[model samples]
Target chain A: MSEYTPFEMIAYTGSRVLKDERIVFVGTGLPIIAAMHAQLTHAPNLYMIYEAGSLAPILEMGMPLSVGDTRAARKACYLKGLCGAFELTQRGCADYAFIGGAQVDMYGNICSTIEGHNYDKPGIRFPGSGGAGAMAANCEKTIAIMALEKRRFVKKLDFVTSIGFGDGAPDYREKAGVLGSGPYRVITNQALFGFDEATKRMMLLEVKPGRTPAEIQELVDFELIIPPDVKEMAEPTDEDLRLLRDVIDAEGYFLKRVIKK
Target chain B: MINTVSSNIKNISTLEYKEKKFEYWGPTPDESRKLMVNKSHALKDKRMSLKEAVGKHIRDGINLGIGGFVNTRVPVAIIHEIIRHGARDLTLSFQSNSICPELLAGAMILDPDRVSIKRVELAWWGYEIIGIAPMVRYLATNGIIEMDDYTNYGMSVRFKAASMGIPFIPVRDHGGSDMELVNRGKMIECPFTGKNVYLLPACHPDVGIVHTTAADMYGNARIFGAYCTCPEIAMAANATIMTTEKVIPTESIRSYPNLTEIPFPVVDTVTEVQYGAHPGASYGYYWFDMDHIKMFRSICEDFRKTGNKDALKKYYDEYIFGCENHDDFLEKIGYKTLKKLKDMDGGQPIILT
Candidate 1:
């Protein structure tokens, strides 16, 4: 078996979670790769709408470097302004939106704004929320992708840049006027997690191959809400790994090269 | 120099203002009156060379809007001129940006004094840094510049509010998010329904620069594809400057009135510059110069690794300073590569009239 990178696993799991015929509102980085993989594999009819205004692009070339990558507009069916694209999401046409963050809470809330408690004087200040806020509020379902680490998988976020499900109470999102049903899944390196319908707390859905439940539990900051039938995640097939390394990421922009150090 | 004023100004009703507790998303009745009044006035032909436009309009510490989405239809020639002129302390705003801001930041234009303090303030309405250029990250991390964030939709709606001459526009997105903390907006209860909505204030830049496929001498501009925020930028800015690949006849603009993105009345200046969105794609005109972009990224990466100012200086010297103007810059890119990019869109070079 060929050794697969954690990024491939994250991408594979994300693609698998996405269903066919769903219009995906995609951000840059890992989400682009996952969407491309899905398009190539199970979901050929997956329509992608980039925040930069390209809609339903064929993505003839490999994965775009960013949502604004020129490839995103190549042969696009419709080109809109930034406002028009989000307006569609607000109208609830987008079934899923893929987002990444610096920190995620148990309720699936994402914090990409700052690290420390103080907003003005932070331990670390990230590039503040862009479209993540709007995507979280409007998209019918949000799929959050992040690195699995103790700090990242926090019990509480430093700041709520995007609300998942406020306290995970029933009708919490509805009260906030969010059109979508908060986060459907949180895909990380070690395992896959889903939000509890009632509480909105993240529950360990499945562990990836070679990684034990105990190993994932160690990494998470919050307590695990493992169900009785917790199963091992399916490993990337030979074909999946081959397509990822060879076709989608032939240039190694995402897989091999670490642009953001 | 050919000079002609735009004679057509349609009579649109100005909105009237009645004191309402709820903030409208568009122009209020009173503000609509001003916009309608502004629309009635004809725009004089203020055509000039790209150099003249930059010199006459741009100033230090100016709030500028560089219009484009990602790599599409960026006003590259105007940006090159701003760099060439050494404009300082610019507060740059964009909804969805690409290489233009990064190039400025990389050239040390954002920090002309070589001090750690940034001369530029970068305000964008997007989630992540979209470009491959490293300057944005460098500025944010090094505390060189003040970074203000807004959602892509939030920023665009703010522009829309400015275009309509409104004080603020109410939006539904930022109600529960922490966007309200950094961004200047208020969560007010809707008087009619008692529901809450975020009210985003209107933002009008000192100058809005956009590149379009064609514009008349009167600055009636027509964008071919993906008219991102050009119309809003044009209407919202105190002054609007347009760079275009071709300057067609006013009759042609009149022929397709509905297709015109920026009407003549809103345009302050127009400069005809071919290949104005190089290293970025101008839809239906040329594809992105990927090789050039790759080279730029490498330069940026090298600078990030070394923390050497000379690396960026060398790039500016080679790409921006070494070239006299847009034509010279295109020449440095060479005719072959330019031809290949243009051929990708099956477009012929616009012959200067």
Candidate 2:
């Protein structure tokens, strides 16, 4: 019906990944918007656990400034301490954890640590891993949401801030004593990627509309594992965009004005 | 070739190296027990001025824990006092900080040559180096303060271990990341399961400061919403300082014993400072003063651009040093604005049915 923003598309895609009645471990930014969208839309029974310990919050009004925002705890089912919230993940309670990172490698290992190899002397230091590492290690599955850029999609992360499929081998996480299976899908601006079962390397699953495989290849620094049955990513429908704009992000705090023509 | 053995070999070697290099920094289990036993004698009316609390307890080179997650319920008033009193060589330990750590690092409070105080050391997990507060990046980039990083969960569990008076706690997370490499903890076999687990050592700060909605004159504190790590921090720290919106009578606190997060025995000082968590939200009391926070950010940005402390000095002078105390600071915020903020929310705590 109307032109939509890329953030709307990304949020819509992220919402689509969630199933009904799943327990999602969500953080502040875009993940909150996506999870809220899912709750309002298809997955009404989805339970949300904010990293700051607000569990199943009834997000009534304005978007919460942070996971620990008082609004998040306002009608929450259970408000735990930081230890208790993460302990749930450790106990294998969360069904999905939505996270974003600075860089993600072919193996889906995300790096939010120092850009330079040296920890002492970093060329550029992003914020060190918060709860993303723990969630990735403990959740049943992790969904990495980030803008698609060549710099972000790398051959090797500067540092493994969160383990996905370590070294792209089977039983790698098991051997590493990681309880979770790492990222199941990486939702990006241009496309969606899923890990190959045999290799555990990220493979191109779908390209977004109006984008070609050649263009997607050009955007990535590393070689993409292209599957033969790769299909075009479904664009946000009229209803999806309507719900996203009207109900989910009514204030357009996250999805509004972010998209550039 | 699966190449599983090589990876396994690499991991085992790393694990062995980590174990060999592991060193505990804080008090031992026995020492912690002794300290708790010594300190857990009696509960007194620890009510004192914010100045007295900061000056008497927060000394140079003491490991400090400032409690809060992001902007909610942070000890801003206490932090301002710390800066004003010129506490030096303070080693700050926190998990998932927002404005508190950024202000501490950016305020040039740690500049030894300039301020003539010992440089501050910061050990944090998940700093607000993102869009919210990027001054930490500037501070770290210039080597203004020594920095150590940990995962949020790791830091929380460390506080839990300290509270429990245990030497270290076993965790299944943070095994494969760079956090494992840099973490002071060692990878050990869980004797029960014979599986590898990270043993995060106890973190007992010399002083822990927390701001809450209400507390009694005897230091029994209660937080209305989102009690992140304040309770754990209070239990873990050697001494706890509480700043509250109001100091209620002991009877009121006793009426709701279940809501008491920090008991009087654990708290060493109780300072009554209304709107104490200014520029930050104090749950049901008031929302975050975004304009003030923006002003803080602008000052930081000016410092970043000019590489001069003039802007920071001006900010400190006007907001912190200029004010005599929390009351003076509240005066600067203006009563009308405060009333408006308080009234906007009906001046009531959200009671969830």
- Candidate maximizing TM-score: 2
CA lDDT of every candidate: 0.73, 0.75
TM-score between candidate 2 and the true structure: 0.92
Each model's TM-score? 0.85, 0.92
Candidate 1 C-alpha lDDT tens digits along A1-261: 677888888889989988899999998877888888898899989988888677898766557776765567667888767777888898888899899888887888888766666544455556556678888878899899988889888877777778687566675555454578779999986799997776778889999877778899899898878887777887788999988888888878777744353
Clashing pairs in 1: A130-B126, A130-B127, B15-B29, B16-B29, B17-B29, B17-B30
Docking level of model 2? acceptable
Candidate 1: residue B262 Cα off by (Å): 2.1
- Candidate 2 lDDT, A1-261, residue by residue in tens: 567777887888888889998899987667887888788778999988887787888877556756777777767888877888888888988999888888888888888866766555566666677778888889899999977888888876777778788776676677566788787999986799998888887889899878887888888888888988889887778888887788776767677654432
Regions of candidate 1 where Cα sits further than 4 Å from its true position: A1-3, A61-63, A115-125, A166-177, A241-250, A258-261, B1-40, B43-46, B107-133, B142-144, B294-307, B343-353
Error of 2 at B174 (Å): 0.8
**Model 2, C-alpha of B240: deviation from truth (Å):** 0.8
**Candidate closest to the true structure, highest DockQ:** 2
Error of 2 at A189 (Å): 1.4
Candidate 1's displacement at residue B16, Å, is: 41
